[model samples]
Target: MSVAATRRLNLVTEPILPRIRPAIAALAPYKQGKQAGPDAFKLSSNENPFEPLPSVLEALQRTAPINRYPDATASRLRARLGVRYGVNVEQVHVASGSVSILQQLILATAAAGDEVIYAWRSFEAYPSLPLVAGATGVQVPLTADARHDLNAMADAVTDNTRAIILCTPNNPTGPIITSAEFTAFVERVPADVLVILDEAYAEFVTVPDAVDGLAERVYEKHPNVVVLRTFSKAYGLAGLRVGYAIGHEKVLDSARTTGIPLSVTSAAENAGIASLDAEAELLERVAVIVERRTRLLEGLRAAGWDVPDSQANFVWLPTGERTDEIAAAFVANDLVVRPFSGDGIRISVGEEASIDRVISVATSVR
Candidate 1:
């Protein structure tokens, strides 16, 4: 086309483009977990280092035709989870991952003027989901020790608040909210505001007083409560990408209505079933992780790294401004750990061998 024709076309298009939704333009894309090299020790993303249980492996080997579509309702897996959790099948919904369910939950319940409440520096996805849903994000700052301040979180709730997400044994930080505190918080929260109890790391936590708020008790009494769990962590099925939400039928129905893609793959469903069946075996691996987490913390403390008492499968090194130096040193030693802020590096507790290598690198860096 001639220069004048092209100029006129551009002028017309520019005005039309400005009419696009402001929310879409202002939104930030979700940043995914860090990647690790083949030869490096990857402690990013808080994944279980354990191989899939033999049963899960066998199930995958027996994989059916991938050419066919998956069960949109995911009936068999839902049935098994219902029986396991003692909830009606209608109360449970499965998704490719807990993150997908979280996104669906946000979209279903919140609108442009509504709000989604969560802790800062918690799950990286927490803030992004609200922006995508065109909802305001109320991020309460973490307490000095890096735990969620439930009181402040509850106080932040306003008439516009539609949902609150709580990540127990919080990622990056590792402190868990007690049952009593959560119970009190819930009682104060408005009945209509949905509280999402994200228990993705629950299976790894072994505290006697540790709040397993996602247990059947909460769901039974609180119609507004929803618990999210995943096979990605303790079940060691991260590659399979299966997670589920347990809540009242009404709440689940709203989330399901958002239309999760039907083809979640039959392989993921089979893997989940196999993992659930191998619970005892998976727990054994979890025990090892717990032990490693303890030893790793003790080691870091002895080396004067000021580590927190982490219940998750990873330990955080709060080095403040030295975070970059520390993380760079690990990379120099051919190790990979997730770094956050200028002071924190989350190192996953892997196999005994990998743990030793990480410890050595940390010691050298220090």
Candidate 2:
């Protein structure tokens, strides 16, 4: 942060962004935790604590020639997913992660001067995707308790609004919008404007009122609706990077066309199919995560810290200005928790030992 340090950092001689697309230049690089090293206990990216199931590992081992091109259509994975979800194969499109799929959707639908709406504290990808697609972003403030103010978001719609991203059990704050709320909001949104329900953490949520009927809601009722999901979280396959989106065939077609790399890698495709087959095993891991999340919430609260009722695999520390201090303390203890603007620290629920480290560090904070 010193001028001398800044000067040292400025040694690169490319005019910072020389000749890059203006849109690309405008993006500050995405920050993730430091990769493996002696001091790394990364609980930053909200990955599941469990390793890939035995079936998934076996599938990977049995996979044939890596040099050969993958199935362009990802036919086997698509067929399995479609059958499992009771939807037509055309309705589902797979990508590296939900992030890629999201980018493709924005590129397909948004253009210069158009507006894309999402909650202020929702997925970090929401803002970047719209901007990268050459559209303006409309960030609505969260409600009093850190939940999406769906009514206000609906009111933000304008003639130029092309899409709205609703991140359920919202990242860093795990509150889900009710089905009634979504229904009401959907009714108000224009038919031409796409409404994306990002359910990356869907498996972690246990609320009765929470909406998990994303496939049905999007594919059956609303032509403009798109649902994004991932195998990274509950399925324990973040490294494999397989995610999917379900929408009307036409909307899915647009994403397929715009998405890079043609399809998810064959390894990821095979892993996804194997993951589906291990649903029971994955659900058991999910149950453990839910239990651990409960313990984390209760422990944090009992230690006199204010925390939200989380339905996701992570807990939010909404202490605003204290975030830096907390994150520093965590780092000192060899744990890495994500810090956001104001006083937010998102700590992923990991194994008991990792959770204990977080609790210990948090409790030691003055």
Candidate 3:
């Protein structure tokens, strides 16, 4: 970028707004995935293609009056999740969504001068969350194949490190961190530092050996560890905003202390419980998306794109410097995509009809 037209993501050259922290002023608010035109498929956000489950709707309809405050503790939902994860109710924490919980955890553990580590080009939220806590973010670059570099991440740890976030079946890239890889990486981390396993898309992952934070009970062995899960993706509850965490009781208590009170509504809590009751049907829907993802991955590779083998409901296209150009083509063809300039495009596995158009656009560009 030319100096005259230069805009830095964090470089501060101008006067700060009155009463604003320089750190906060240097950053911009997060931008959501681009919205598509009415006739176009919104393939930018990795949302579930299936409609909301009947159970969730029924639960919402039966919700109590809105005048009264919701159960701030989300007691019933926490109990249900606790039983599902084979842990005590104290081990489960519910919030608006996993991202809210992530922010809460960052606030609880990190502060000025502390360092928080995560793999870059993984999750868009990871880099920005630490900034909110006044902590410096240490971005470890992903491997050439678009997976986390766990070894390098472990080496990046220092005495000032306060927390580390691991996104399995990572967003955009869609590659999972294996169980073996997580275990070895945790061994290198200090016991006092926090390790957050953000498994927001765990329901979509198909690999047998991928990291299972709750099933394996990594927290039982590593008390500093916390696993985050969300209903937004698989349960079609993105609009409802419900997510939960499973781990050590004390660690969750700390997160709760830092959370915004009454953020999880009664409607959201009821829907989460109903979704859990209807998990079998939801898994069936997930199976369909998994097949769609497989088809999309195969077609992209057949079109000569260097796409990653995604276990989640999305695929990555390494369009390099042509990212903007290729993404524009997809948009022109009515398939909105998320593009990171100079890096790649992440197209969500959307409606069945969007599959061919995505591939067709890439083929034409190539």
Candidate 2 lDDT score relative to the true structure = 0.85
Candidate 1 wrong stretches, greater than 4 Å: 1-26
lDDT tens digits by residue: candidate 2, 122-232: 777777888888889999999878899999999999999999999888997888988888888899998999998989999999888887756346548878999989998
For every model shown, what is its TM-score relative to the native structure?
0.92, 0.93, 0.94
Query: Model 1 over residues 19-38: C-alpha lDDT tens digits?
Result: 65676677667655568788
At residue 363, give the lDDT of candidate 3: 89
Q: Compare the candidates by TM-score and give the number of the best one.
A: 3
When superposed on Cα atoms, how far off is each prediction in RMSD?
Answer: 2.8, 5.0, 6.2
What TM-score quantifies how close candidate 3 is to the native fold?
Answer: 0.94
Question: Against the unseen true structure, what C-alpha lDDT does each candidate score?
Answer: 0.85, 0.85, 0.91
Error of 1 at 187 (Å): 0.7
**Residue-by-residue lDDT tens digits, candidate 3, 1-366:** 676556563376765657988888888788789998989999888889888887779999988799999999999999999888788899999999999999999999999999999998888988888899999999999999999999999999999999999998888799999999999999999999999999988999888999999889999999999999999998889988999999888888889999999999999999999999999999999998888889888888998988987887789999999999999999899999999899999999889898888888888998
Instruction: Report the error of model 1 at residue 278, Å.
Output: 1.2
Which portions of model 3 show Cα errors greater than 4 Å? 1-17
Better of 2 and 3 by lDDT: 3
